[model samples]
Target: MEDKTEEKKVISIEDRIPKLKEERKKKANRRLIFYLTIFFILIACVVYLQSPYSNVKEITVTGNDVVPIEEIKELSGIDDETNIWMLQKRIAKKDIEGHPLIESMTIKRSLPQTVKITVTEFNIIGYTEEKGKYYPVLVDGSVLKDYPMSYRGDRPFILNFDEQAYMEMIATQLNELPEHVLRLISEVSWEPTKNNKNKILLYMNDGFIVDATLRDFSDKMKNYPSIIAQLDPKEKGIVHMGVGIYFEKIKKK
Candidate 1:
């Protein structure tokens, strides 16, 4: 009987030696390429960070009316030589907001070494005199200790109200009025009645007085220009709007 068992093939380590070497070479090449790529990236980062191209070349300030752009830049402590990557936005914001006129501020980094600083400043609607000093009142009912020397004549002078609350109410109301109506106001005085504590009087630049309450001062005062347009421009009198909207011409003696 012939043997039916199958013969097992003999495998030699010498025959597989070339394949093993090829696999090892491929792995080594891959590892070397990876290490070289990592080294190049590290070098590139160092070069970019150390170069002057990474430094802030310009800073633009926007949304500033009361505070000067130079002042804002100075307060931020960032200049052309400042590194854009090293700038701490929170710290810069805090510094810029330290100004009495600035209400809020934001700092942003623009590409190619530029920083933009946008600020929202408190609008000085009018001025109120306390004691001998004249303080500028902001839209948010905040009074600044520094008196405006140049713009004093442009804003209305608030008088006869000693309480800060009343002054704040007047400021808030004036802030809500339109720019045309605000420009028409030459003076605002706190004249409270027995019935309404928010009563205030507005003296117009067109030789007319407005009696309005803080409850609806903005809504009622907006019609002032139209009201003036309807009446005789030469006539000077009180335009009553506290209780009901009407015109009361002062009788000439």
Candidate 2:
């Protein structure tokens, strides 16, 4: 009876081994969680202090000029008092596009509370010589500005399509053209005859006229660099490479 009593006393506490291990495991888990939480909080605080949320420390502009800096800054609503940590870059980006001059904008936030704004301004592709001031024609065909006009430049004249869609199509194609070919083109007259987007008249810079049809457009253009090598500008003629490729001349100017 004495042995049984002592054995029971020892076994009673010892039998709860599973429970003790479980308690230890739970305690360890809680400690691990606490440490991780603390670590994350420290990281967040460090990041916050380094970011622009502390204040609008600096505003930078790149790949932009058409849109005035003051206008972009105003639209951004960024000030020296702004919390660098609390700012959302997308909000500023959307606001920047509100300006007529900005075609697209990218806003990025950098360390030390700086806002880096990268912008793509719309190209001034076509101009109308009106009132002795050159009114710039937008890709969407809406016009802006009243600057002095001169005919000495190689500005392409837009013809054929209506103002709105024409502006966009031309703007898109301008970049795809070869730099050499682009310079040679003095005027671009759109002669879209039902389902033909490629029909155009290129009044070349060398005083030569190109009567071209759009078929094999890029290929034909590639051929032209070699072809022009053989042709001369002094030989004034309709360089008709349209349907049947050849040249025809006017008797006089």
Candidate 3:
């Protein structure tokens, strides 16, 4: 009878009901915590948006020269009443760069209540005179007509360059020349000969004059320092760089 006996084991749903209930409770509790966190975050955002602390309280401007600080600030279209979080960086940049002198600009947010603006102005290469007033010339060969004033002689003066196209070419050439060569030039005049339409006269600060054509002007001027070094410093004369390089002495009166 013992050899023939068999045993059976079974589990009922009631035995597993408590474990399933515990697992479901844990999942529901986690879901509830997640919802509460999201709800609190949304409420905090709304409160912050309505608070006065989110408004811009300080504005800073830097890297500007010809354009006045006050004028740049006014052009930015931003003020203390603007919300720091709602600032339109592109709009502000466009408005500020609309000025002729402003080449580019950048806007940055410095946290809680500060906005900063930086600008880069065009490089002032020289000045052109019109009606006894001097206007600044930029590297791009544009003259600032609205900024006419007295000449300080800090930069070279462009004289008798009525043709805009020629002036632009000359500006490009000057930009290509080395800084040392540029500083030595006090004045540039359009002195065309019957045979040469591009002839130009450069009045040097060191009392010497340079005669050359606009074509290859930058390349030729590179050797000017070496040429001047070989000449008698006390004897001022015209250094001809066209056709052949030679020095014609200015006879003492």
Candidate 4:
């Protein structure tokens, strides 16, 4: 009877505690994984909504003319109140491209916070006079914009020529003008009054005039100060600085 009681007391772990504990552990691990997955899903959704593409907070302008900043924004539909993330570069480019005055533009971003605009201005070749009104000419020599009578009177300019044609000839030369000559020039009329082709009048501040043909204009205009040095500054006369630097100085009548 004692031997029979000892065999019964020796219970097998397979029939009880070990199996139960393993089942419990599997259930607990599944629960933990479920909770972790839910947590990460919530985090990913939040991140996606708050990313750079969803919003815009700042707008900046650089390399611009003071006159066009506000106007450009209006035309571009890029309002001060608009979000940066909403800006589309292609759309913006299309908007401003209509304005002939604007040469080029580039847009950039600052993370999720800001947008920047960079601009390059049109090249001005000469100036135009219409019914005593004056306007700056673009590189193509077209009238950039109109001006009033106050702009007229003794400005040197390339005389009447097609705006587009003149730009190719005169734009580079205008850029190369010396600081002294540049300052002294009152106007640049395309196609002069006398046999207008290939000729321009550069009116000087020192009461002299330069009849400069477009050919070798940069070189001719470069020597203008020395040309002015020999002239009588007080007299109202024309100094021909167009071809080979000739100064026909005449006293005021």
Question: lDDT of each prediction vs. the true structure?
Answer: 0.83, 0.70, 0.87, 0.65
| TM-score of every candidate | 0.78, 0.56, 0.75, 0.66
- Residue runs of model 4 more than 4 Å from their true location after superposition: 1-55, 131-134, 144-158, 162-168, 178-180, 190-197, 230-232
RMSD of 2: 7.4
lDDT of 2 at 69: 86
1 or 4, which is superior by lDDT?
1
Best by TM-score: 1
Which 10-residue window in model 4 sums to the lowest lDDT?
Answer: 146-155
Which pairs of residues collide in model 2?
A: 52-84, 52-85, 52-113, 53-83, 53-84, 53-85, 54-84, 54-85, 55-84
Tens-digit per-residue lDDT, 1-253, candidate 4: 9987776666664467878998999999999999999999989867856664546555676777533577677666775455565677898877766566677888887876677777776755455667666676655445655322234333346455565666667766776776556667776556545665777776656656667777677787787777667766665566565434555657445
lDDT of 1 by residue, 84-105 (tens): 8999888888887877888899
User: What lDDT would candidate 3 get against the real structure?
Assistant: 0.87
Residue lDDT tens for model 2, 1-253: 9999999999998989889999999999999999999999999998877664678779888887555687788888888887776776778878888666688888777877788888888866666555566565665666665433444354566555455565566655654567677667777677777776667777777777777654444345545667767777577766777566676765783
Model 1 score (lDDT): 0.83
In model 2, the Cα lDDT at residue 19 comes to: 96
Ranking of all predicted structures according to TM-score, beginning with the best and ending with the worst: 1, 3, 4, 2
Top-scoring candidate (lDDT): 3
